[model samples]
Target: MATISTLSDLYISELKDLWSANDQMARALKKITPQATNAKLSQLLEEAQTGIADHTQLLKALIANQGEEVSKEHCKGMEGLVSEALKHVLEQPPQNGPVLDALIIAQYQRMTHYGITGFGTVAAFANALQMEDDGRQLKDAVDDLYDADELMSELAEAAVNREAAEE
Candidate 1:
Protein backbone atom coordinates (compact mmCIF):
# COMPACT_ATOMS: atom_id res chain seq x y z
CA MET A 1 0.00 0.00 0.00
CA ALA A 2 1.26 3.46 -0.85
CA THR A 3 0.71 6.75 0.89
CA ILE A 4 -2.37 8.56 -0.37
CA SER A 5 -1.42 12.18 -0.77
CA THR A 6 -3.82 13.05 -3.57
CA LEU A 7 -6.99 12.05 -5.34
CA SER A 8 -4.92 10.16 -7.90
CA ASP A 9 -3.60 7.92 -5.16
CA LEU A 10 -7.09 7.26 -3.89
CA TYR A 11 -8.22 6.52 -7.43
CA ILE A 12 -5.40 4.07 -7.90
CA SER A 13 -6.26 2.38 -4.61
CA GLU A 14 -9.87 1.96 -5.70
CA LEU A 15 -8.74 0.53 -9.01
CA LYS A 16 -6.50 -1.94 -7.23
CA ASP A 17 -9.36 -3.00 -4.99
CA LEU A 18 -11.63 -3.52 -7.97
CA TRP A 19 -8.93 -5.51 -9.72
CA SER A 20 -8.69 -7.85 -6.77
CA ALA A 21 -12.45 -8.15 -6.53
CA ASN A 22 -12.73 -9.11 -10.21
CA ASP A 23 -10.01 -11.71 -9.85
CA GLN A 24 -11.78 -13.23 -6.87
CA MET A 25 -15.08 -13.24 -8.73
CA ALA A 26 -13.51 -14.98 -11.71
CA ARG A 27 -12.40 -17.83 -9.48
CA ALA A 28 -15.70 -18.02 -7.62
CA LEU A 29 -17.72 -18.07 -10.83
CA LYS A 30 -15.71 -21.05 -12.05
CA LYS A 31 -16.64 -22.94 -8.90
CA ILE A 32 -20.28 -21.88 -8.95
CA THR A 33 -20.89 -22.33 -12.68
CA PRO A 34 -20.67 -26.11 -12.39
CA GLN A 35 -23.34 -26.06 -9.71
CA ALA A 36 -25.86 -24.31 -11.96
CA THR A 37 -28.22 -26.61 -13.79
CA ASN A 38 -29.70 -23.85 -15.93
CA ALA A 39 -27.94 -23.64 -19.25
CA LYS A 40 -28.44 -19.91 -19.62
CA LEU A 41 -27.15 -19.25 -16.13
CA SER A 42 -24.08 -21.42 -16.70
CA GLN A 43 -23.34 -19.63 -19.95
CA LEU A 44 -23.68 -16.23 -18.34
CA LEU A 45 -21.36 -17.22 -15.54
CA GLU A 46 -18.76 -18.34 -18.05
CA GLU A 47 -19.11 -15.08 -19.92
CA ALA A 48 -18.77 -13.14 -16.70
CA GLN A 49 -15.48 -14.90 -16.07
CA THR A 50 -14.18 -13.51 -19.34
CA GLY A 51 -15.52 -10.05 -18.60
CA ILE A 52 -13.83 -10.03 -15.24
CA ALA A 53 -10.57 -11.04 -16.81
CA ASP A 54 -10.79 -8.18 -19.29
CA HIS A 55 -11.67 -5.72 -16.55
CA THR A 56 -8.74 -6.93 -14.48
CA GLN A 57 -6.43 -6.32 -17.40
CA LEU A 58 -7.83 -2.82 -17.83
CA LEU A 59 -7.18 -2.07 -14.18
CA LYS A 60 -3.60 -3.27 -14.48
CA ALA A 61 -3.05 -1.05 -17.49
CA LEU A 62 -4.58 1.94 -15.77
CA ILE A 63 -2.39 1.46 -12.72
CA ALA A 64 0.76 0.94 -14.74
CA ASN A 65 -0.01 4.00 -16.83
CA GLN A 66 0.22 6.03 -13.65
CA GLY A 67 3.83 4.81 -13.21
CA GLU A 68 2.83 2.90 -10.10
CA GLU A 69 3.56 -0.72 -9.48
CA VAL A 70 0.72 -2.99 -10.55
CA SER A 71 -0.51 -4.65 -7.39
CA LYS A 72 -3.74 -5.58 -5.65
CA GLU A 73 -4.93 -4.68 -2.22
CA HIS A 74 -7.05 -7.44 -0.72
CA CYS A 75 -10.70 -6.68 -1.26
CA LYS A 76 -12.40 -7.71 1.98
CA GLY A 77 -15.83 -6.69 0.63
CA MET A 78 -15.59 -9.19 -2.19
CA GLU A 79 -14.17 -11.81 0.14
CA GLY A 80 -17.28 -11.58 2.32
CA LEU A 81 -19.62 -11.68 -0.68
CA VAL A 82 -17.85 -14.73 -2.09
CA SER A 83 -18.01 -16.47 1.26
CA GLU A 84 -21.72 -15.70 1.58
CA ALA A 85 -22.33 -17.05 -1.90
CA LEU A 86 -20.50 -20.27 -1.07
CA LYS A 87 -22.48 -20.55 2.15
CA HIS A 88 -25.71 -20.35 0.20
CA VAL A 89 -24.49 -23.09 -2.08
CA LEU A 90 -23.36 -25.32 0.79
CA GLU A 91 -26.59 -24.84 2.72
CA GLN A 92 -28.50 -26.25 -0.20
CA PRO A 93 -27.73 -29.95 0.03
CA PRO A 94 -28.77 -30.71 -3.54
CA GLN A 95 -26.88 -28.03 -5.37
CA ASN A 96 -28.55 -28.28 -8.79
CA GLY A 97 -31.69 -27.40 -10.70
CA PRO A 98 -33.93 -24.34 -10.36
CA VAL A 99 -33.53 -23.70 -6.64
CA LEU A 100 -29.78 -23.49 -6.93
CA ASP A 101 -30.10 -21.43 -10.05
CA ALA A 102 -32.21 -18.89 -8.20
CA LEU A 103 -29.64 -18.66 -5.41
CA ILE A 104 -26.84 -18.31 -7.93
CA ILE A 105 -28.63 -15.50 -9.70
CA ALA A 106 -29.16 -13.68 -6.45
CA GLN A 107 -25.53 -14.01 -5.47
CA TYR A 108 -24.39 -13.09 -8.94
CA GLN A 109 -26.43 -9.89 -8.90
CA ARG A 110 -25.11 -8.93 -5.50
CA MET A 111 -21.54 -9.19 -6.75
CA THR A 112 -22.34 -7.40 -9.99
CA HIS A 113 -23.83 -4.50 -8.04
CA TYR A 114 -20.58 -4.26 -6.16
CA GLY A 115 -18.65 -4.12 -9.41
CA ILE A 116 -20.97 -1.47 -10.83
CA THR A 117 -20.42 0.74 -7.84
CA GLY A 118 -16.67 0.22 -7.80
CA PHE A 119 -16.25 0.96 -11.48
CA GLY A 120 -18.57 3.92 -11.36
CA THR A 121 -16.68 5.36 -8.44
CA VAL A 122 -13.37 5.03 -10.19
CA ALA A 123 -14.84 6.63 -13.29
CA ALA A 124 -15.96 9.55 -11.19
CA PHE A 125 -12.50 9.83 -9.82
CA ALA A 126 -11.07 9.83 -13.31
CA ASN A 127 -13.37 12.65 -14.31
CA ALA A 128 -12.41 14.61 -11.22
CA LEU A 129 -8.78 14.26 -12.23
CA GLN A 130 -9.58 15.56 -15.74
CA MET A 131 -8.80 12.19 -17.28
CA GLU A 132 -11.63 12.03 -19.78
CA ASP A 133 -10.41 8.99 -21.65
CA ASP A 134 -9.98 7.00 -18.47
CA GLY A 135 -13.37 8.11 -17.26
CA ARG A 136 -15.01 6.99 -20.49
CA GLN A 137 -13.37 3.60 -20.35
CA LEU A 138 -14.33 3.06 -16.74
CA LYS A 139 -17.90 4.15 -17.42
CA ASP A 140 -18.10 1.67 -20.28
CA ALA A 141 -17.05 -1.10 -17.90
CA VAL A 142 -19.66 0.04 -15.41
CA ASP A 143 -22.32 -0.02 -18.09
CA ASP A 144 -21.39 -3.58 -18.98
CA LEU A 145 -21.72 -4.63 -15.36
CA TYR A 146 -25.12 -2.96 -15.19
CA ASP A 147 -26.25 -4.80 -18.30
CA ALA A 148 -25.27 -8.13 -16.79
CA ASP A 149 -27.12 -7.33 -13.58
CA GLU A 150 -30.26 -6.35 -15.44
CA LEU A 151 -30.11 -9.56 -17.46
CA MET A 152 -29.87 -11.58 -14.29
CA SER A 153 -32.92 -9.83 -12.92
CA GLU A 154 -34.80 -10.63 -16.08
CA LEU A 155 -33.76 -14.25 -15.84
CA ALA A 156 -34.89 -14.45 -12.26
CA GLU A 157 -38.27 -12.80 -12.76
CA ALA A 158 -39.09 -14.34 -16.12
CA ALA A 159 -37.73 -17.83 -15.67
CA VAL A 160 -35.53 -18.96 -12.78
CA ASN A 161 -37.86 -17.99 -9.98
CA ARG A 162 -40.79 -19.61 -11.72
CA GLU A 163 -38.81 -22.78 -12.19
CA ALA A 164 -37.76 -22.71 -8.54
CA ALA A 165 -41.40 -22.42 -7.46
CA GLU A 166 -42.30 -25.37 -9.59
CA GLU A 167 -39.48 -27.32 -7.98
Candidate 2:
Protein backbone atom coordinates (compact mmCIF):
# COMPACT_ATOMS: atom_id res chain seq x y z
CA MET A 1 0.00 0.00 0.00
CA ALA A 2 1.15 3.53 -0.77
CA THR A 3 1.41 6.39 1.69
CA ILE A 4 -1.68 8.63 1.72
CA SER A 5 -0.12 11.97 1.03
CA THR A 6 -3.16 13.51 -0.66
CA LEU A 7 -6.90 13.15 -1.01
CA SER A 8 -6.37 11.44 -4.34
CA ASP A 9 -4.24 8.81 -2.65
CA LEU A 10 -6.91 8.29 -0.01
CA TYR A 11 -9.55 8.02 -2.73
CA ILE A 12 -7.61 5.37 -4.59
CA SER A 13 -7.03 3.46 -1.39
CA GLU A 14 -10.75 3.50 -0.64
CA LEU A 15 -11.51 2.26 -4.11
CA LYS A 16 -9.12 -0.62 -3.63
CA ASP A 17 -10.65 -1.47 -0.28
CA LEU A 18 -14.13 -1.51 -1.77
CA TRP A 19 -12.96 -3.78 -4.55
CA SER A 20 -11.63 -6.27 -2.02
CA ALA A 21 -14.72 -5.97 0.14
CA ASN A 22 -17.00 -6.71 -2.79
CA ASP A 23 -15.02 -9.79 -3.71
CA GLN A 24 -15.21 -11.08 -0.14
CA MET A 25 -18.94 -10.35 -0.05
CA ALA A 26 -19.50 -12.29 -3.25
CA ARG A 27 -18.00 -15.40 -1.72
CA ALA A 28 -19.89 -14.92 1.55
CA LEU A 29 -23.22 -14.56 -0.25
CA LYS A 30 -22.69 -17.82 -2.07
CA LYS A 31 -22.23 -19.61 1.23
CA ILE A 32 -25.06 -17.77 2.97
CA THR A 33 -27.76 -18.04 0.30
CA PRO A 34 -28.04 -21.80 0.41
CA GLN A 35 -28.30 -21.76 4.19
CA ALA A 36 -31.29 -19.42 4.13
CA THR A 37 -34.57 -21.25 4.54
CA ASN A 38 -36.71 -18.34 3.42
CA ALA A 39 -37.27 -18.25 -0.31
CA LYS A 40 -37.26 -14.45 -0.43
CA LEU A 41 -34.03 -14.27 1.54
CA SER A 42 -32.41 -16.73 -0.84
CA GLN A 43 -33.55 -14.74 -3.86
CA LEU A 44 -32.28 -11.47 -2.38
CA LEU A 45 -28.89 -13.02 -1.65
CA GLU A 46 -28.62 -14.17 -5.28
CA GLU A 47 -29.49 -10.70 -6.52
CA ALA A 48 -26.93 -9.15 -4.17
CA GLN A 49 -24.24 -11.38 -5.66
CA THR A 50 -24.96 -9.87 -9.08
CA GLY A 51 -24.91 -6.37 -7.61
CA ILE A 52 -21.53 -7.03 -5.97
CA ALA A 53 -20.08 -8.16 -9.29
CA ASP A 54 -21.32 -5.04 -11.04
CA HIS A 55 -19.95 -2.83 -8.29
CA THR A 56 -16.56 -4.54 -8.48
CA GLN A 57 -16.34 -3.75 -12.19
CA LEU A 58 -17.28 -0.15 -11.53
CA LEU A 59 -14.56 0.15 -8.88
CA LYS A 60 -11.97 -1.25 -11.28
CA ALA A 61 -12.95 1.24 -13.97
CA LEU A 62 -12.84 4.10 -11.48
CA ILE A 63 -9.35 3.11 -10.33
CA ALA A 64 -8.13 2.71 -13.90
CA ASN A 65 -9.48 6.16 -14.74
CA GLN A 66 -7.30 7.59 -12.01
CA GLY A 67 -4.23 6.04 -13.71
CA GLU A 68 -3.85 3.49 -10.95
CA GLU A 69 -3.39 -0.21 -11.47
CA VAL A 70 -6.55 -2.22 -11.00
CA SER A 71 -5.58 -4.24 -7.99
CA LYS A 72 -7.05 -4.67 -4.51
CA GLU A 73 -5.44 -4.73 -1.13
CA HIS A 74 -7.02 -7.30 1.12
CA CYS A 75 -9.77 -5.75 3.24
CA LYS A 76 -9.30 -7.13 6.73
CA GLY A 77 -12.56 -5.60 7.97
CA MET A 78 -14.62 -7.58 5.50
CA GLU A 79 -12.51 -10.66 6.02
CA GLY A 80 -13.25 -10.64 9.73
CA LEU A 81 -16.95 -10.07 9.21
CA VAL A 82 -17.18 -12.90 6.71
CA SER A 83 -15.25 -15.23 8.95
CA GLU A 84 -17.57 -14.44 11.88
CA ALA A 85 -20.63 -15.11 9.75
CA LEU A 86 -19.29 -18.40 8.57
CA LYS A 87 -18.50 -19.35 12.13
CA HIS A 88 -22.06 -18.62 13.16
CA VAL A 89 -23.41 -20.76 10.36
CA LEU A 90 -21.11 -23.66 11.05
CA GLU A 91 -21.21 -23.70 14.84
CA GLN A 92 -24.94 -23.56 15.30
CA PRO A 93 -27.09 -26.67 15.55
CA PRO A 94 -28.56 -27.86 12.26
CA GLN A 95 -32.18 -28.28 13.24
CA ASN A 96 -33.28 -24.66 13.55
CA GLY A 97 -34.79 -23.31 10.33
CA PRO A 98 -36.25 -19.88 11.00
CA VAL A 99 -33.65 -19.16 13.65
CA LEU A 100 -30.87 -19.80 11.17
CA ASP A 101 -32.59 -17.60 8.60
CA ALA A 102 -32.86 -14.82 11.13
CA LEU A 103 -29.17 -15.10 11.93
CA ILE A 104 -28.34 -15.02 8.23
CA ILE A 105 -30.37 -11.88 7.74
CA ALA A 106 -28.52 -10.19 10.58
CA GLN A 107 -25.17 -11.17 9.13
CA TYR A 108 -26.23 -10.05 5.67
CA GLN A 109 -27.24 -6.66 7.03
CA ARG A 110 -23.84 -6.20 8.66
CA MET A 111 -22.11 -6.81 5.34
CA THR A 112 -24.49 -4.47 3.49
CA HIS A 113 -23.88 -1.75 6.05
CA TYR A 114 -20.16 -2.01 5.44
CA GLY A 115 -20.74 -1.60 1.69
CA ILE A 116 -23.07 1.35 2.26
CA THR A 117 -20.47 3.14 4.32
CA GLY A 118 -17.63 2.37 1.89
CA PHE A 119 -19.49 3.60 -1.19
CA GLY A 120 -20.73 6.65 0.61
CA THR A 121 -17.21 7.50 1.72
CA VAL A 122 -15.90 7.14 -1.82
CA ALA A 123 -18.70 9.30 -3.17
CA ALA A 124 -17.78 12.00 -0.69
CA PHE A 125 -14.17 11.77 -1.75
CA ALA A 126 -15.19 12.05 -5.39
CA ASN A 127 -17.23 15.14 -4.61
CA ALA A 128 -14.30 16.66 -2.76
CA LEU A 129 -12.11 16.02 -5.80
CA GLN A 130 -14.66 17.82 -8.01
CA MET A 131 -15.48 14.64 -9.90
CA GLU A 132 -19.24 15.05 -10.14
CA ASP A 133 -19.83 12.10 -12.46
CA ASP A 134 -17.86 9.72 -10.28
CA GLY A 135 -19.62 10.98 -7.20
CA ARG A 136 -23.00 10.41 -8.83
CA GLN A 137 -22.07 6.90 -9.84
CA LEU A 138 -20.89 6.00 -6.36
CA LYS A 139 -23.98 7.55 -4.85
CA ASP A 140 -26.16 5.44 -7.14
CA ALA A 141 -24.40 2.32 -5.91
CA VAL A 142 -24.91 3.43 -2.33
CA ASP A 143 -28.60 3.92 -2.98
CA ASP A 144 -28.91 0.41 -4.37
CA LEU A 145 -27.18 -0.99 -1.31
CA TYR A 146 -29.52 0.93 0.97
CA ASP A 147 -32.51 -0.41 -0.92
CA ALA A 148 -31.30 -3.95 -0.42
CA ASP A 149 -30.76 -3.34 3.26
CA GLU A 150 -34.24 -1.94 3.63
CA LEU A 151 -35.73 -4.92 1.89
CA MET A 152 -33.87 -7.22 4.20
CA SER A 153 -35.21 -5.35 7.19
CA GLU A 154 -38.72 -5.68 5.90
CA LEU A 155 -38.28 -9.38 5.29
CA ALA A 156 -37.01 -9.86 8.78
CA GLU A 157 -39.82 -7.90 10.39
CA ALA A 158 -42.60 -9.31 8.25
CA ALA A 159 -41.76 -12.99 8.33
CA VAL A 160 -38.36 -14.21 9.42
CA ASN A 161 -38.41 -12.80 12.92
CA ARG A 162 -41.93 -14.06 13.53
CA GLU A 163 -41.03 -17.52 12.37
CA ALA A 164 -37.91 -17.50 14.48
CA ALA A 165 -39.92 -16.49 17.53
CA GLU A 166 -42.02 -19.58 17.06
CA GLU A 167 -38.96 -21.77 16.89
Candidate 3:
Protein backbone atom coordinates (compact mmCIF):
# COMPACT_ATOMS: atom_id res chain seq x y z
CA MET A 1 0.00 0.00 0.00
CA ALA A 2 1.07 3.59 -0.52
CA THR A 3 2.26 5.53 2.54
CA ILE A 4 -1.13 7.22 2.80
CA SER A 5 0.12 10.23 4.70
CA THR A 6 -2.47 12.55 3.18
CA LEU A 7 -5.97 12.11 1.80
CA SER A 8 -4.45 12.23 -1.66
CA ASP A 9 -2.21 9.32 -0.76
CA LEU A 10 -5.15 7.39 0.63
CA TYR A 11 -7.27 8.06 -2.46
CA ILE A 12 -4.58 6.81 -4.79
CA SER A 13 -3.94 3.82 -2.59
CA GLU A 14 -7.61 2.90 -2.69
CA LEU A 15 -7.66 3.17 -6.46
CA LYS A 16 -4.78 0.73 -6.60
CA ASP A 17 -6.46 -1.62 -4.15
CA LEU A 18 -9.68 -1.60 -6.13
CA TRP A 19 -7.76 -2.34 -9.31
CA SER A 20 -6.34 -5.47 -7.75
CA ALA A 21 -9.75 -6.38 -6.38
CA ASN A 22 -11.30 -6.15 -9.80
CA ASP A 23 -8.60 -8.38 -11.26
CA GLN A 24 -9.16 -10.98 -8.59
CA MET A 25 -12.92 -10.90 -8.96
CA ALA A 26 -12.70 -11.06 -12.75
CA ARG A 27 -10.48 -14.13 -12.63
CA ALA A 28 -12.72 -15.84 -10.14
CA LEU A 29 -15.77 -15.05 -12.24
CA LYS A 30 -14.11 -16.54 -15.32
CA LYS A 31 -13.72 -19.85 -13.51
CA ILE A 32 -17.04 -19.68 -11.71
CA THR A 33 -19.20 -18.42 -14.57
CA PRO A 34 -18.90 -21.76 -16.36
CA GLN A 35 -20.30 -23.48 -13.34
CA ALA A 36 -23.59 -21.61 -13.57
CA THR A 37 -26.31 -23.72 -15.16
CA ASN A 38 -29.09 -21.18 -15.64
CA ALA A 39 -28.83 -19.37 -18.95
CA LYS A 40 -29.54 -15.94 -17.49
CA LEU A 41 -27.12 -16.52 -14.67
CA SER A 42 -24.45 -17.54 -17.16
CA GLN A 43 -25.13 -14.47 -19.24
CA LEU A 44 -25.01 -12.23 -16.21
CA LEU A 45 -21.73 -13.77 -15.17
CA GLU A 46 -20.25 -13.13 -18.59
CA GLU A 47 -21.42 -9.54 -18.56
CA ALA A 48 -20.05 -9.13 -15.05
CA GLN A 49 -16.62 -10.20 -16.25
CA THR A 50 -16.78 -7.52 -18.91
CA GLY A 51 -17.96 -4.98 -16.36
CA ILE A 52 -15.10 -5.86 -14.05
CA ALA A 53 -12.68 -5.33 -16.89
CA ASP A 54 -14.20 -1.95 -17.61
CA HIS A 55 -13.96 -0.90 -13.98
CA THR A 56 -10.32 -1.96 -13.95
CA GLN A 57 -9.64 0.29 -16.91
CA LEU A 58 -11.36 3.14 -15.12
CA LEU A 59 -9.18 2.58 -12.06
CA LYS A 60 -6.08 2.63 -14.22
CA ALA A 61 -7.13 5.86 -15.88
CA LEU A 62 -7.90 7.40 -12.50
CA ILE A 63 -4.47 6.46 -11.23
CA ALA A 64 -2.78 7.91 -14.31
CA ASN A 65 -4.89 11.05 -14.09
CA GLN A 66 -3.69 11.42 -10.53
CA GLY A 67 -0.15 11.61 -11.91
CA GLU A 68 0.79 8.23 -10.56
CA GLU A 69 1.91 5.07 -12.31
CA VAL A 70 -1.01 2.78 -13.04
CA SER A 71 0.15 0.30 -10.49
CA LYS A 72 -1.92 -1.69 -7.97
CA GLU A 73 -1.74 -2.82 -4.41
CA HIS A 74 -2.90 -6.35 -3.68
CA CYS A 75 -6.35 -6.09 -2.14
CA LYS A 76 -6.44 -8.65 0.62
CA GLY A 77 -10.08 -7.85 1.30
CA MET A 78 -11.05 -9.01 -2.17
CA GLU A 79 -8.62 -11.86 -1.94
CA GLY A 80 -10.59 -13.17 1.00
CA LEU A 81 -13.91 -12.60 -0.74
CA VAL A 82 -12.71 -14.39 -3.87
CA SER A 83 -11.32 -17.19 -1.80
CA GLU A 84 -14.69 -17.70 -0.10
CA ALA A 85 -16.39 -17.66 -3.47
CA LEU A 86 -14.04 -20.29 -4.84
CA LYS A 87 -14.36 -22.34 -1.72
CA HIS A 88 -18.13 -22.48 -2.06
CA VAL A 89 -18.35 -22.89 -5.83
CA LEU A 90 -15.15 -24.63 -6.95
CA GLU A 91 -13.03 -25.99 -4.11
CA GLN A 92 -16.03 -27.78 -2.68
CA PRO A 93 -18.32 -28.11 -5.61
CA PRO A 94 -22.00 -27.59 -4.99
CA GLN A 95 -24.51 -29.96 -6.55
CA ASN A 96 -25.13 -29.02 -10.16
CA GLY A 97 -28.24 -27.47 -11.66
CA PRO A 98 -30.49 -25.10 -9.72
CA VAL A 99 -28.75 -25.82 -6.42
CA LEU A 100 -25.39 -24.88 -7.87
CA ASP A 101 -26.96 -21.92 -9.58
CA ALA A 102 -28.28 -20.71 -6.25
CA LEU A 103 -24.88 -21.15 -4.68
CA ILE A 104 -23.34 -19.21 -7.52
CA ILE A 105 -25.66 -16.31 -6.94
CA ALA A 106 -24.83 -16.27 -3.26
CA GLN A 107 -21.12 -16.27 -3.88
CA TYR A 108 -21.37 -13.74 -6.69
CA GLN A 109 -23.43 -11.35 -4.60
CA ARG A 110 -21.00 -11.57 -1.73
CA MET A 111 -18.18 -10.46 -3.96
CA THR A 112 -20.34 -7.82 -5.59
CA HIS A 113 -21.18 -6.32 -2.21
CA TYR A 114 -17.48 -6.06 -1.46
CA GLY A 115 -16.87 -4.20 -4.70
CA ILE A 116 -19.74 -1.87 -3.98
CA THR A 117 -18.35 -1.00 -0.59
CA GLY A 118 -14.83 -0.48 -1.83
CA PHE A 119 -15.83 1.61 -4.84
CA GLY A 120 -18.27 3.66 -2.82
CA THR A 121 -15.58 4.43 -0.29
CA VAL A 122 -13.10 5.61 -2.87
CA ALA A 123 -15.74 7.59 -4.66
CA ALA A 124 -16.38 9.55 -1.47
CA PHE A 125 -12.68 9.97 -1.05
CA ALA A 126 -12.43 11.27 -4.60
CA ASN A 127 -15.23 13.73 -4.04
CA ALA A 128 -13.75 14.94 -0.77
CA LEU A 129 -10.50 15.49 -2.61
CA GLN A 130 -12.44 17.60 -5.13
CA MET A 131 -11.82 15.19 -7.99
CA GLU A 132 -15.39 15.52 -9.15
CA ASP A 133 -15.08 13.68 -12.44
CA ASP A 134 -13.25 10.75 -10.92
CA GLY A 135 -15.70 10.65 -8.03
CA ARG A 136 -18.68 10.58 -10.33
CA GLN A 137 -17.14 7.86 -12.44
CA LEU A 138 -16.48 5.72 -9.41
CA LYS A 139 -19.99 6.28 -8.10
CA ASP A 140 -21.33 5.26 -11.49
CA ALA A 141 -19.37 2.05 -11.17
CA VAL A 142 -20.98 1.46 -7.79
CA ASP A 143 -24.40 1.93 -9.34
CA ASP A 144 -23.61 -0.70 -11.92
CA LEU A 145 -22.62 -3.16 -9.25
CA TYR A 146 -25.82 -2.42 -7.35
CA ASP A 147 -27.86 -3.07 -10.47
CA ALA A 148 -26.13 -6.40 -10.92
CA ASP A 149 -26.86 -7.33 -7.34
CA GLU A 150 -30.51 -6.45 -7.76
CA LEU A 151 -30.73 -8.63 -10.83
CA MET A 152 -29.21 -11.51 -8.94
CA SER A 153 -31.82 -11.05 -6.22
CA GLU A 154 -34.56 -11.01 -8.81
CA LEU A 155 -33.21 -14.20 -10.33
CA ALA A 156 -33.15 -15.87 -6.95
CA GLU A 157 -36.68 -14.85 -6.05
CA ALA A 158 -38.10 -15.43 -9.53
CA ALA A 159 -36.60 -18.86 -10.11
CA VAL A 160 -33.25 -20.03 -8.80
CA ASN A 161 -34.16 -20.31 -5.15
CA ARG A 162 -37.44 -22.08 -5.81
CA GLU A 163 -35.75 -24.47 -8.16
CA ALA A 164 -33.05 -25.21 -5.62
CA ALA A 165 -35.65 -25.87 -2.92
CA GLU A 166 -37.53 -28.26 -5.16
CA GLU A 167 -34.31 -30.16 -5.76
Cα error, residue 66 of model 2, in Å, equals: 0.5
Q: Report the C-alpha lDDT of model 1 over 15-100, residue by residue, as the tens digit.
A: 99999899888888888888888888998888888889989999999999989889999999999998898878755535447888
Model 2 ranges off by over 4 Å: none
lDDT of 3: 0.94
RMSD of each: 1.2, 0.9, 0.8
TM-score of each: 0.96, 0.97, 0.97
Please give the CA lDDT of all the candidate structures. Answer: 0.90, 0.93, 0.94
Instruction: Itemize residue pairs with steric clashes in candidate 1.
Output: none
Candidate 1 residues lying further than 4 Å off, grouped into runs, are: 91-96
Candidate 3: the clashing residue pairs are: none
Off by over 4 Å in 3: none
For model 2, residues 55-153, the per-residue Cα lDDT tens digits are 999999999999999999899999999998888875663468899988999999999999999999999999999999999999999999999999999
Ranking of all predicted structures according to lDDT, beginning with the best and ending with the worst: 3, 2, 1
What is candidate 3's TM-score against the reference? 0.97
Between candidates 1 and 3, the lDDT winner? 3
